[model samples]
Target: METVLHTDKLTKTFGRLCAVNRLDLEVNRGQVFGMLGPNGSGKTTTLGMLMGVTNPTSGSFTWFGERATHLTRKKIGAVLEHPIFYPYLSGQKNLELNALIKGADPANIEKVLETVELSDRKQDKYKTYSLGMKQRLAIASALVGDPVILILDEPTNGLDPMGIAEIREIIKRIAADGKTIILASHLLDEVQKVCTHFAILRKGSLVHTGPVEEVGKGEEVVEVIAYHDDLPHILHEFRGSLSVKSENGKFLVRLRDDFHSVDLNKFLFEKGIVASHIVTQKKSLEKQFLEILQETTSHRQPT
Candidate 1:
């Protein structure tokens, strides 16, 4: 896959505070990449540097294998905070004006409007539209130039559930069309649902980066209980078990990725042990996210 964006030791500081620290990133084509973090974790600051709105204190970035410049930025469509439009202008008219500014083809206006599901409301004035409609129009403006890469910051920030869902669907559709999307959001659920790859940032440091699937599939935790009192011995003898600890009168066994609850049960059965209960607990992205934060926090604490 082609790298759409690459950063080398990107750093940004404000007085005594480092908003972004030696951050290295690689965003590939045809990927919906999510920059996930709590508020003030450099998500917006990083995006700002990439979009040229904020100057980096150090480091450099490249777009399409070339250093970031005005010409390079033109190849990317971005909405950092919010979109601005003339209240009196109709949605289509607003997009037309944006197309003119970007030198984009006028024909793409209708296509982008359709993509954002605003074709029906294209003639409606921007101010008269609902909050969701307004957000969609902002996305439409970004698409006016038919850029290959899209960067969004908190796309669903202040919206209700329905509006959030609407934007998510739009993002999914755009990603499906093979556009490289770099989104910064604090919403873990949204990233898990829409992003293929994600990086977790905590206090301006990258704590984790990997495919979304790997985030929640690190290890399988199995809850097992057996009728026999020799459960500890059986657990210790099970080669597939990574670790086993007694919790709430039941054994919580951590199994390797290649092993499952059934595998553990079979191994115990072959050793003359019968488990009365076996439950596999699949990890969630939120859980993994919290764990990463907790681990990083512990490491940062004074010893």
Candidate 2:
């Protein structure tokens, strides 16, 4: 599979501080590649360089297999941070302005408006539009040229629940149509739902980069919630790696990889401990995200 975007030892510095360290990234065609990190982790800076807004202090990158040349910018559409629109112009007019700048077809205005579900409010002035609507319009601007790659930074910020849901669905549909996506977000749940691959950055440095499922790595952790006080004691004896979490008057024991649900049930029954709940947490993107976050946090000293 051909990579739509590739970076090799890309670095950026702002005077005394390094905003983006020597980072290597590869985003293949039709894959939703997620960049996950805390604030000021160089997510924005990396995107800026990739989108040609920021200059790299050193290193190299390629888009669509060619070097990061001026012509490659035409094949990509991007929305970075909060979108700024002309408050006085109608949504249609704003998209028209961008479409014209991109040298895209005027006929695409209606198509993209419909794609972002903004056809009904196309005539509404930008100031009258909701935050979600503005985002939709921003995304519509990206879709107008029908570019192969879409790069978005924190696309769901300030959106109400419904608006977030709408954007999530739209992104999935775009991916289904085979457009490559480079998404940078702090919204772990959103990333988990939409991303096929992920690269986690910490303090401008890349920590973990692989398939989304790789982060979901580890043993199948089964959680046994018990009401008895002795359950924790009994659990400690049989576990290789256990996480004992207490909540709602019960102890939640995360069983080790070698333990089976049936084995735990049998042990609990024989030991005379009442099992309140036996829930298994499936290997999920959320679980993986949190593990990575915790690991990163541990390495940093409290100031």
Candidate 3:
């Protein structure tokens, strides 16, 4: 895959506060990449630096293997929080104004509007449109320049479920068209659904980065119940067991990364124990995310 964006030790600070730590990241072309983190994890600050709106205190980034320049901004479209559109003007008019500012050909405006499904309401005044429609318009404005990459920060923020679904569909469609996307969102489920690749940040530092499909490939969790009175003690002593908890009269056992239910079953059988109930399930992205955060927290704790 071609490298679309690369950052080497990218750092940003405001006085004593390090908004973004030394971050190294790479995004491949045509991949829908997600930046996942809590609100204060420096996601916005990092995007600001990448988009040229904020300067990095130290570090460097490149676009398409070349140092980012003013021209690079033309090839990338972005929409941040609380976008401003002319309320009194029609949706079409607002886009036309935006296109003028972007130096994009006016001919592309209609295409972008249609792409965002706003053509039917093109003549409607911006103020009259619902919140979802406004967000779609903001996206259309970004698409007007025919940018190869689109950066969206909380694109579905403050919207109803239906609005979120609409924006999600639009993003999928855009990604299907082979455009690289950098989605900065605190919504884990949304990122899991929309992005092929992801990076997790905590306290302005990168904690995890990988393909979304590989999120829970390692580690296994199983719910089990045994007739033996010593089930809890046996579970704790199991070599493969990482943690065990009792929930709803069943023990939820988390195994080591390289261990599975088979290993646990074998060990139990050796001890002359047979489980009355056993159910195995792969760890979910949400679980993996929480575990990652927990591990980072533990590492940071004072000894």
Candidate 4:
């Protein structure tokens, strides 16, 4: 895949405070890439740097394997914070004005509006649109330019569940069309659902980066239950168990990355123990995110 964006040792400082630290990243073509972090974690600042709204204090970055300039920026459609449109104007008119300003083809208006499912409301005044409709219109403006990449900051923030879901589906559709997307959001679930790759930031630093699937492919935790008398012996005999604790009449066993629940059951069966119940708990992205934060926090503390 072609590299759409690349950064090397990117750093931003506000006097004594570092808003973004020595960050390095590469976003490939056709990737739905996510930048995830809590508030004040520099997610927005990083996007700002990429968009050229904020200058980097140090280091450098490139878009499409070349230096980012006004012309290069035109190839990227972006929405930061919120979409802007005239309240008195219709949705189609709003897009037309945007298309004119962006030098985008006027013909793109109809297609982009339909892409966001706002074609029916194209003649309706922007003021009459719902918050979700307003957001989708904002995305429509971005699409008018037919950019190679999309950069969004908190695309679903401050919206109800239905609104969030609507925006998410639109984004998924855009990614399906092979447009590279780089989105910065604090919503872990949104990233897990939409992004193929993600980078977790903590206090202006890059803490973790990988494919989304890898986040859930960590060590397995098996919940097992055997006869009351056999439980203690099974726990004591399990060599692959990392930690074992009793919870709700079952043994919650944390196992090494290579271990599985079936392995535990096999081990017990060989020893003449029959487990009444056993289940493998699939790790969620939220859990993995918290664990990464905790690990980074611990590593940053003084010895």
Candidate 5:
């Protein structure tokens, strides 16, 4: 795959804080990459640097296989944490300015507005639009120039469920057209649904990066909900092959490194206890994220 964006040893420091540590990233042409981390994990700062708004303390990045320059930046589009627009201008008017500034065809104004499903409200004053609507307009501006790469930082931050779904669909359609996209969000479910690959960061450093599904793959996990008083003794049946995660009335079981869910379930069933419920689940991006974050809790430096 062709790399549309690449970074090497990227770092950013402010006074005594390291907002972003030595990080390397790669986004292939047409791939939708996700960045998963909590607030202050440098996701926003990283995007700011990638968009040329902030200077990196020590590192290098390239767009379109060449060092990022004002000229090459034309191929990128972005919607940072909050969208910016002229409150007094109409939605269409704001987009018109963005279109012209990017040197895009004036007719692209309506095309992008429609893509973001904001065409019906194009004439409304920016200040009159709801927060979610304003975000849609911001995305419209980014899409006007038809950039090959789109970078969004918490694009769905303030949206309700329906609004979130709307934006997610729009992004998927963009990627379907073969444009590369990079989404930075705290919503693990959203990332699981939209991205092909993801990287998880903790304390300004990356802890995991791989195909989305693979990142969530680890030892098998099962949730057992049984109304039994002697659950602890029942758990002993799984001792040699199952690592007991919790013994609460409802239990979470981690299959021994070498055991599979099927084998474990069969064992539980043979032990004469009614397994009220058994759900096989992957390790989950959230689980992996928290686990890694715990590892770095003591090492976390103010950033």
Candidate 6:
């Protein structure tokens, strides 16, 4: 639980607009921390300030318990957007050049290529690789420096399902090796599956922050599907039912405190409703995310 990064009231403004306001965050070593928000919720601006590409208007940050500096920045590697590499150069050659620029040892190039699963295609020209391969190469380039932390913004943007799965696996692999990663993505599913902890940002302010596992832990949620048309109304009228939502031909019934799935099943039996499917489901991250946004809608500032 060593602190790898800390920000104190980090603020950034442009002319009359405040892009980021009084942001405070702490990331620990060996953590895959996710920063989640909409496109204009200051996720990118906060990352820019942390990476030294954009100066902060006020506040400060520290890396490895030391104040931000050139030396401290070297311990981190980042990819803010689509990476650009020489189209004509081979993937291996491109990584060599990147290592030189970062002052990383040339000897680490082969290991990083293997780490990103690009060893077989390392000799292929950068332009010849698919979109997925190009992205893997970018990650390989970032790992060549042997950084303690890696920062990625929208690492799976514009990729197919297969490509997204590949990147997700690679990220999990990196985290398994005890490297700290700060990932900024609007994809709630990605954060739920990959990150240990997450912070939700709304209108440049924090709305919620907590462990992904603890979301909706105390709530009772049950999924049911019945052929009868009156199933929805029946569920709504059931005792202890808080709400019922339909998705993909299934009804998710959330119950009040002390109400269990057994109570729901017993109620359905008494109503003579035969369910075709029934199971308890962990509350999904998407559901929780929407609820959080709805609760904060009135408190949001104009931006």
What candidate 3 gets wrong by more than 4 Å, as runs, is 222-246, 249-280
lDDT of 4 by residue, 1-303 (tens): 799999999999999999999999999999999999999999888888998999999999999999998888778898887877899999999999988877899999999998889999999999999888888998999889999999888888888999999899999999999999998899999999999999999989999999998876868888888875767666767888989888988889999878888889899898888888899987878999999999999888957
**Taking the tens digit of each residue's C-alpha lDDT, what string does model 1 give over 1-303?**
898889999999999999999999999999899999999999989998998989999999989999888777767888887777999999989988988877889999989888888999899889999877888888998888999999888889789998999999999989998999998899999999999999999888888888897765667899998888788877978888889999998999998779888899889889888788999986877888998999999889957
What does the lDDT come to for candidate 2?
0.84
**Candidate 2 lDDT score at position 56:** 98
Name the candidate that leads on lDDT. Answer: 3
Q: For model 3, state the Cα shift of residue 126 in Å.
A: 2.1
Give one digit per residue, the lDDT tens place, for model 5 in 1-303. 798888999999999999999988888887889999989899999999988899999999988889888767667788888999999999989988887778889898888888988989898899999989988888888898889888888889989999999999998999899888999999998898899999988668887788886865657777777667776567667754455666555677777666666675677778766777887777667777787777777456655
Regions of model 2 farther than 4 Å from truth: 225-247, 258-276, 282-303
Poorest lDDT segment (10 consecutive residues) of candidate 5: 239-248
**Candidate 6, residue 211: lDDT:** 83
* TM-score list, all predictions: 0.84, 0.85, 0.82, 0.88, 0.85, 0.85
Winning candidate number (TM-score): 4
**Which residue pairs collide in model 3, if any?**
none
**lDDT to native, each model:** 0.89, 0.84, 0.91, 0.90, 0.84, 0.89
lDDT of 3 by residue, 1-303 (tens): 799999999999999999899999999998899999999999999999998989999999999999988889888989876557989999999999988877899999889998889999999999999888888998998899999999999999999999899999999999999999999999999999999999999989999999999976877898989998889999999999999999999999999978888889888899999988888986567878889999999999957
Per-candidate RMSD, Å: 3.4, 3.3, 3.8, 2.5, 3.3, 3.4
Scanning candidate 1 in windows of ten residues, the lowest lDDT window is 210-219
Model 5 clashing residue pairs (backbone): none
| Model 6 TM-score (2 dp) | 0.85
- What does candidate 6's lDDT look like per residue over 93-112, in tens digits? 99999888788999999998
**For model 3, the run of ten residues with the poorest summed lDDT:** 279-288
